[model samples]
Target: MTTTQDFPAMSGSLQEPAPFWRRRTGTVVTSAALVAALFGGVTGGVVGALNASGGGVAAVSSPVALNASSTSDVSTIAAKVLPSVVQVNVRSGQGEGLGSGVVLTPDGRILTNNHVVAGAQQVTVTLSDGRTVDAAVLGADASSDLAVVQASGVSGLTPAKFGDSDRVKIGDQVVAIGSPEGLQGTVTSGIVSALDRTVTVPGTSTGRRDSSVSYQAIQTDASINPGNSGGPLVNAAGEVVGINSAIYSPASDGGQAGSVGIGFAIPSDQVQQIVNRLS
Candidate 1:
């Protein structure tokens, strides 16, 4: 029996500027020069956007000299948060898919992307320690692209700490945890490349109401890919600040494809609202 979860307000908007490195230049400059320009501009935009959001540009500090103590570490973070991160598998009569999710409550409430389990006949959640459990839809919001699911007979589930995304600054280190390409419990690290980036996600409905959702995301070069959707983007303090969403892979023929050291994650502040509604 196929079940459909209704995701209200599950879309978002896009706000990154046109990558400047692809522009044409004077006769003297070669194609290589264009590529260099593009790389520089994209990188600069990432940093600039963060600065702009954080108020103003500050002096660049040396990475070596910065040593702020935090309760988050690889072993500690993994042990504490891994059980919360789950593998979401959706199966319909005609198709099947796999994605990532996080346990938001001890009583089986889980958080994931609405699109992940939108039209599944059955949904299964796999834990980090290899426990698979059947899951039911709690509520979904399409405009926000967020969903909440519930599992029965699940115990000892650890919920993740939600961080204030608005307090994040440029150059802040971040960690992404999820199942990329079906590989569960994968972890990647990178800096908060940008913030307040608006991306347009295609709306669920058609016709006049077929508008897009504007999302202010946290941009990073953390190697997020297919199957990583809905995973948590954690801060140095091991708090989740964003949810891994989309990648800007232009077409190869004068376009972009794959990770070119650029990736995006939805801000946790926005996600918290949807999660709260489900709770």
Candidate 2:
């Protein structure tokens, strides 16, 4: 089932569609035994999104340095950041969800949205290098909508550098990297529309704001679609500033879904704290 969240205060004569948290579905909890289910070097469709963006993509064979010196240009930043971003495919029994993730460490640690991997029975991470590896969730925090997963066996990983969201100013140039509509490694560009915006989400509990989860978000005008969840929202310098989480679907055509040039992300500062505990 597709679910969304929005500002309850802005109710109109015709209620608008709530912004969707994640475009996909699935909530079956799997055990750690899943780590041994897949055979080594045996690749199967992991049910993921394939990311593609406006600018051209660099060859997956070339090693793009995550710390490469980058100017305030979009292509330059993408070349550096793309190598660190990954496509996350999760399956929970008969249900499956698609999302994106950023490499947090050279050892294959990944950071993504909790809604993306929550209750996932199996997870497969596809690197920019065209290799897929098995992943296991370390921990998930629903309050922040963030989660961390670690690869069982992987090497030569390129980790994205996260920036200080506290010093981020409004109108700064930014980019969104993720798999939109099953397109993996897609990049989109935009400016920071707002800062520290308060957003409420439908939580594990039911009934309106009583049991909702709120988050301090970094708002952007980037085109983040359903599959973009858990991807990294990076700065012009190729540093990750936030984790792409939700998008604002406008009240049009009976509330058409997808990004309407309005997207929200969990600030990197909050993500850092969550990943710290997971690591």
How far in Å is the alpha carbon of 12 misplaced in model 2?
A: 8.9
Q: Candidate 1's residue-wise lDDT over 171-203, tens digit each?
A: 777656776556688776667777765554433
Q: Which stretches of candidate 2 lie over 4 Å from their true place?
A: 1-72, 204-210, 252-256
Give all candidates' CA lDDT scores: 0.53, 0.57
Root-mean-square deviation (CA) per prediction: 13.1, 11.2
Q: Which candidate wins on lDDT? A: 2
lDDT of 2 at 119: 56
TM-score of each: 0.70, 0.73
Question: Candidate 2 lDDT (Cα, whole model)?
Answer: 0.57
Which residue runs of candidate 1 sit more than 4 Å off their true CA positions? 1-72, 205-211, 253-257
